[model samples]
Target: MPKMKTKSSAKKRFKVSATGKVIGSQAGKQHGMIKRSNKFLRNARGTTALSAPDAKIIKGFMPYDR
Candidate 1:
């Protein structure tokens, strides 16, 4: 069979963790941070693990990552 192509967008946006979880940057922080609460900004400061359902979908896009 031919090689499977990884989704370029997924490769750029998400990463497969060592334990097989999908790690991605938190959403809603790309713009308008001035309107957001300090707590919200603090909480969203780092990468987050994608939820199970969401990770499943991302995994499909990155078949070779796992």
Candidate 2:
């Protein structure tokens, strides 16, 4: 059988955690930081685990990741 291909965009944007959760960078930090509050900026740092529904979809894209 032919190998199933991973989605290129998904590979770049998301990662699977050791416990099988989807890990991704926090959103809304790419631009216009001057208008964003300090608390928002502080909280947005680093990666976050995606919700169950969202992680299920991401897992579909990365079949071999788990």
Candidate 3:
């Protein structure tokens, strides 16, 4: 059987943590930010874990992570 390939886009956007959680950056921080609130900007500064269902889907693409 052929090897299953990882999804390039998913690989770039998502990361599998040491404990097997999928961590990802918050959106809306990539574009213009001057109009956004200070609190909004601050909150978007770190990675957040994906939900259970989304994490399952992300794990498929990050097979090497586990």
Best of the candidates, lDDT = 1
| N/CA/C clash count, model 3 | 0
Give TM-scores for every candidate, taking all chains together and pairing residue i with residue i. Answer: 0.96, 0.93, 0.80
- RMSD after CA superposition, every candidate: 0.6, 0.8, 1.5
- Of candidate 2, the 10-residue stretch with the lowest lDDT total is 14-23
Residue-level lDDT of model 1, residues 9-53, one tens digit each, is 999999999999999999999899999999999999889999999
Write the candidate numbers in order of decreasing TM-score. 1, 2, 3
Would you list the C-alpha lDDT of every candidate in the order shown?
Answer: 0.97, 0.96, 0.88
lDDT of 3 at 44: 87
The backbone clash count of each candidate, in order, is 0, 0, 0
Clashing pairs in 1: none
Model 2 clashing-pair count: 0
Best by TM-score: 1
lDDT of 2 by residue, 29-62 (tens): 9999999999999999999999999999999999
Stretches off by above 4 angstroms in model 1 are: none
lDDT by residue (tens digit), candidate 3, 1-66? 777788899999998888989999988998889899999999889899989998999899867777
